[model samples]
Target: MGKTPAELSIPAASISTEIPDIPVSIPSQLLERRPDIAVAERQVAAANAQIGIAKAAYFPTVNLSATNGFQTGTLSNLFTTAARYWALGPAAFALPLFDAGARGAQMAASIDAFDASVAAYRQTVLTGFQEVEDQLAALRILEQETEIQNKAVALAQEALKLTSNQFQAGTIGYLEVMTAQVVALDNQKAAIALLGQRLDASVLLIKALGGGWQASEIPNRDKIGGKTKWSQFLPIPIR
Candidate 1:
């Protein structure tokens, strides 16, 4: 049976808890998810695998081959040990000293793929930043709006109650009471809708940031810069 997503995932305990928790300054918790980070990481691994495949093309391939044959003038000779001849030897080596740009094409393709992956990773990071910023801004605005709406609802509800009492006292008609009630309901609904929007925006921001991929866990710039060959294959900027 195949491993489930949770089973296949890196253990949470292996990750450092030194990374700070996401702050709840804004209503959205979306950036905390970091879905894009995980995607970029996977892309980096795939690009590295591709690079390995490309590098293999530059190395000489060696193979061992063996053969056993039996020649018999009679059916009885087929089962005789003397009738069998066995041979074993290293197979031929056809090293590609040069191809009509085949190796060059492969190298170029691999490099291009690496470059593309880097770009994609950068874009994902930028997108994450943008989402967080936008969501934070939206959250702030929505919070303010919600507060205003709540006040409006409260005021409308008080007005409706007052109008109701006045109608019962025969100082106002039923229509006035109905109008106030409708206004209060509308304000309450608007507040609820704004609250929902804030929640949605938070979720979106979390997804953009690459859910659970903590920025603090990223290796230092110096360490990333020191790496020569394999590290270059990483999709995201290791720093």
Candidate 2:
């Protein structure tokens, strides 16, 4: 969409407080959804067809024809007096008996092309798996970091509350309260940044999984306080 983010009607409250529950081991068949894998498979099919064409060159080609009609010698009695007859024979025949060497070379070349296509298809599948694994690993590691950072934020908030109370009672200077405020703010900022990283990882993992995956497959957050659905963050419907 060419529209700005504000035009998309995404609510800030849609942001997930906990990471979505994604499976660590993905099925190999999911890689088939990727466009590059589809293209590579198509190329392999074309190469196999070419091999068939090459093998056909070694076989003989035969052309046959047949005709049946009325035959009469008299022009006036052509329709009334006629004899029924039919003829069938080979009109043309060809067999490259002396060109076996050339045909063999063609067949070899076709086989080579097919092998190359198969290799390319395998490579494409491997690459797709690699990308998905990379994103999954990133999301897993980021989730751990986010959990630890949340604890840090909580501790900072507690510290700030204590410092503010001391300042109000004249037990501490105003400068100490300001320093506590800065530390609490910085921790909150770090927690927010971690959330952003986790969201980014989720998006990339979705992309790597391809469009065929359904939103239902993404497990919702029941362990967390909120029961936010995965579809809330995604703009488009999964196929």
Candidate 3:
């Protein structure tokens, strides 16, 4: 974009003025392709993991140790109590019997965090659907407007043709022919601008559809030491 005209070297490309044919209804699962939804889903997972970690604090901790040594390398001496000594015992044990409800409070807070993440994920999904709907509606309306503009352009061109013929016949002045030509040109320009709007709307619709991203690209929770139902984590499926 910053290059000089000589260095630009733009490629040859065809421009399409036709409007795209889009369905009235799209699959809800297509929203899974949205990156925001994916991020929110992962946040929910992380919060769920945090809940488990917090609950672990209520459990006890145990430690064990063992030691064995021989005064002599001889097999006979190894069997003798005077030549060998060994010990095995529980090194430490702790049970959180009383923490003034601190462990309970932590567990509750973690659960609340998980709930919040789930809510956030749902909201993100809703926003994605809204964006898609907005673009689709825009395309539909623009298509209709472009169709009407095309008719106006055709009518203006016909009028300009008639005026030109009258001018050549000397029945109408050149000024009359020029006025008709201006009107035709204006209509043509309006039609082109409408086509541009339709193209813009089409691009926005594709972007709302996640730019071809697939739900399969999302990370699997099963491989991360957990088996969460798809409905529990993401209520929608990848279509």
Candidate 4:
């Protein structure tokens, strides 16, 4: 750690100095917190919608037509009641039966895709939970270790002070004083490193919690398709 310029530094930010406990409903609540999980879930939704779209092809296509116009022997009489005429009709067809096999294949592919997405969503959830657990455990252990290191630094400083006093009094050799000084310096440096580890663990824990994102913040799957406006469908708070 001493030889490394790569450091973790977060200004004006801190969490509890102790390890955090996992929520009671980690499995259920994790879905809303993790953006990765949300992405996988949305993919599943999109794939499901594709299945519906593929199935809709099996239904007959209905076409409706209407025409209304006025015709007269002369332009002056074009708007007359005798020239008024209107016609309307409905038409439908399901004649392309040969394409049924292709449609079926497409539907099956969509279903396979949905299944894959679902599997991915579940994997994301599991990974999210594991990361949270890992960071929490690391944070807890680091907190305890930091406290121990602080005590060690304090004790080493006291020892160094005593050694210096003995050296000044000619009761101990200079080598003893140097040893005590080195021990104190190393312990102090290790304490600083422990503090840094705790800070880094906090950052990882925050990421595992999805950076304060909520499931409710996710947009409705329907609004994400076709001509739907994103802002109208998904309201996200800035900042």
Q: How should the candidates be ordered by lDDT, best one leading? A: 2, 3, 4, 1
Estimate the lDDT of model 4: 0.77
Question: How well is each residue in 176-215 modelled by candidate 1, as lDDT tens digits?
Answer: 9889978987987787787678778667655555453345
Per-residue CA lDDT of model 2 for 1-239, tens digit only, reads 89995578854443447766676456666666666877888799889989998999988989889987778786776665356567897489988879648989999999999999999999988888898889888887888998899899899999999999999999999899889989998998898998889888888877887753454444223421235568755768653
Please provide, for model 3 over 105-200, each residue's C-alpha lDDT reduced to its tens digit, 9 standing for 90 to 100.
Answer: 999999999999999998998888888889878877887887898899899999999999999999989899889989998998898888888788
- Candidate 2 runs further than 4 Å off: 1-18, 66-89, 212-239
Off by over 4 Å in 3: 1-25, 65-91, 213-239
Q: Model 2, residue 203: displacement in angstroms?
A: 1.4
Decreasing TM-score order of the candidates? 4, 3, 2, 1
| 117-203 per-residue lDDT for model 4 (tens digits) | 999988988898888889878977987898899899899999999999999999989999889989998998898788778778878
lDDT against the true structure, per candidate, is 0.71, 0.80, 0.80, 0.77
Better of 2 and 4 by TM-score: 4
Question: Which wins on TM-score, candidate 1 or candidate 2?
Answer: 2
Error of 3 at 193 (Å): 1.4
TM-score of each: 0.57, 0.71, 0.72, 0.73
Best by TM-score: 4
Error of 1 at 15 (Å): 41
